[model samples]
Target: MHADADIPTEIQRTLTEFLDVQEQRLAELGPELAEQVQAARDATSGGKRLRPSFCYWGFRAAGGDPERPILTAAASLEMLHVSALVHDDVMDSSDTRRGAPAAHKRFEALQRARSEASGSGGDPVSFGIGAAILLGDLCLIWADEMLHTSGFDAAALARASKFFDAVRVEVTAGQYLDLVAQASGTSDLDLALRVLRYKAATYTVERPLHIGAALGGADQHLIDALSAYGLPLGEAFQLRDDLLGVFGDPAVTGKPAGDDLREGKRTVLVAHAVDHASPAQLAEFERLFGRAELDDDEIQLLREILQDSRSVQACEDLISERTAEAMEALDRSPVQDETSRKALADLAIAATSRHL
Candidate 1:
């Protein structure tokens, strides 16, 4: 979703400063440690800044001051997002992310170069995975340090941290659920939605909003209202992502076509197709859907089957419905800031309307 694209210029500046400080501090350790920090900086550098934007707007909607500490607090979400993506690539065994070789792939290639230079006898692939895993963990730890040192008072930081802690735990648990779904090949639509709720929605929107609202000293009523707006919008966000994973151009989306299918993702789109397809189409889907050998032709065949079963339109309808619901929730929210509320409305459209 790279570089705070849609909103909040200040948030991006704060994030960059925070990372610079992190790099300088890490440099005290050793050059190798600095290299790893550089990897983290590289990984963290660009993104749509979806989480930070949501948090910022949420803080604004609750009438929180446009201040540095809160912005720093919001920027922490970027590191959290980096952690998620790095680990997710490793878990999915994905080849690329945002048009670059994935973190693990980047490290694997580094291992290869070092091996060639030193004539080492280690396994590059394993070394890459190990390094990437540690990098992801470091990103998580860095996010915590950023939050703790964001210059908020203890009471305010604690308030935001409640949501922050819960968000990390929820998303990680959701990740495990998603991995389980992939391994078991569970195609049940309800289970898929559950996984979506835990894995993507909370991290993407809901908790970001909650964290911001908490910092803004929102009442429970306001928090609940924001959750109402965030969750449905968050679902629409992930559903759009699923559609893009299958249908988006590699040139723009930065991953190969059919990458999700290659990973055997049990998306609601695929689950809906499973429910509605004809026997012949189902047969074809099962044959090629999760196979490692899926070629372009097979991928096309799968796309066609999904279309024939009307899953594409069904998913679109869900996105439209959820978007409307999120807007309605925003309308009902007790937020007094008309400008920020309007921005949130625009953000809802941006989240669901883009082809990226």
Candidate 2:
């Protein structure tokens, strides 16, 4: 591990400049719409800004200008990400995000204030969740509108629109697979990898690069090469995320310790543990897995079991292997620009190696 800030200072500066324009554009709406947009903007605070940075560099790597439309598109993608977080927090019933109150929780507080003024008998949590859902929908629509309204010609707009559509479908499918895996208790490694590809790989890395490259008129060969690099990196990133969910410090991660354990996520770590646990250990796991009443002691025991079984080491090894694969893909790709290739490689390393 390395931090993203340590990778490339100039790219970070370019990303900040792009965010300024995006913030201005987000503000240039009707008063009520502006308020909604502002709420969405507020939700974006303290993120890694990884997606937008990916989109920006993807564009630059493909020789696209970081001008108005490109910036707008990148910002719009960020807004879409914010929208996803809002809904995800609601679904996960998560109270905190990025070291602050979740958006739905923020809205619930607003709902409580409004109810107090009106003496209304309404559930603030439900109201807040409903409102956040609607807001997310609005952001998704606005993201499309922003992309469409960018000064690109009809042909370019169509291509970009197609890319966005594919991204949306793939991400949705990934989410569905995640929910299904959680519900069905299926921990097959192959199934887990499939979910990883849809949920993290394509949307997080591959499609972002493809969308930017397509907008920049990149040919199919370059797009394929980028996908080859992005897919493994994205998988490695998700696997790292899964590890953090179980083992990371709550203070740094801004999430509950053992939250994934409580949620019973069928991540690769869990799958490995299940495969390796002895009958006695499996009995303990069966008793504790997905139980809402599991206590800190139980969680600690489960963690110890995972450690004793070497599941953690297995995940670490997998991450290293995937990183090597990603680097190989990047090295073998036909990307001509040394700077862009190095930046992308550095980002892949940073993304997978992040601790929080």
Candidate 3:
């Protein structure tokens, strides 16, 4: 946001350095935990880095210095993000992440090969589950370490701690809501948005901005402004993600197309489709919505329904409206830094319009 292209690069560099330091710290826990540590490292690597960027720019926008304390805090957001993703893969039974073997899948393969090699029978599935759980726990632990040991002053850390703590709560509640929504066959747009807000949007965009701004001692006014911008944009981000989850190319998203359909995700788009379907279409929806064995034909049928029902266009329109609202909020906010404002605006576009 410094109008210098270097700000993001600098943020990425700092984040990398922080992870490296934590990886070195993990090494101190000895060789037995090496595999878990490596998994943690892999999980933390090569992301869009969206949360940290928001935190960093939020800090800058709020008149915080581009120094180690804020940068380290921003890096902690990434750790939390990776922690969520690793656990999410477990919950979703995802086989791949970022175009490679998912944590549980990788561990499962390792366990199977090791058991066969040793000629001693073992349950690789159980082992994979256990190992992946521990690795996910390790990432959560490391996220805490990244934040507390970031050399930030105790006062600043204290200031951010409340919102930082809220991230975990919101994430847990969000996940629970999602699980229940899927199980109960929820298709209400309001419920879907509630799940989106709790499970993803808040922690994904809003809280990171709040945490960073809080570190700089933001008053209620500034925090409110950031939240006003962040919440809508965050919802837009997840809505875009829902689109990709169902309709995107696997090559771009690093997962199978229609993965959400297989998982029976009750996204707002699905909710819309359900709300507007004819009787026969509703019967077809019942048949194919969550069928794991759904073939290409079924997937296509669902897509056509979503498009014809206007759900897809509705989501796109929502994204555009949210993006515009976020920009307007930023414009009216008290943060006077032009460069940071520009950066946040750019992020609004990226988060909404992205293909990945």
Output the better candidate (1/3) by lDDT. Answer: 1
Positional deviation of residue 159's Cα in model 1 after best superposition, in angstroms = 0.9
Please provide, for model 3 over 1-356, each residue's C-alpha lDDT reduced to its tens digit, 9 standing for 90 to 100: 33354544655676567666756776787866667767776777677778888887877777887654676677788878777887888888888888889888888898899889998867988888778888877767767877788777898788888888998899989998888888897587888999989887898899999888887777889999999999999999999999999999898888888989988999988998898878788788878998878899999998888888888989899888987888899999998888888889999888889763
lDDT of 3 at 67: 51
Best by lDDT: 1
TM-score computed on alpha carbons, candidate 2 = 0.88
In candidate 3, stretches whose alpha carbon ends up further than 4 angstroms from where it belongs are 1-29
TM for candidate 1 is 0.96
| lDDT digits (tens) for residues 271-306 of candidate 2 | 888899898998888678877667899999989888
Instruction: Name the runs in model 1 displaced over 4 angstroms.
Output: 1-9
Evaluated with TM-score, which candidate comes out highest? 1
Q: Each model's TM-score?
A: 0.96, 0.88, 0.94
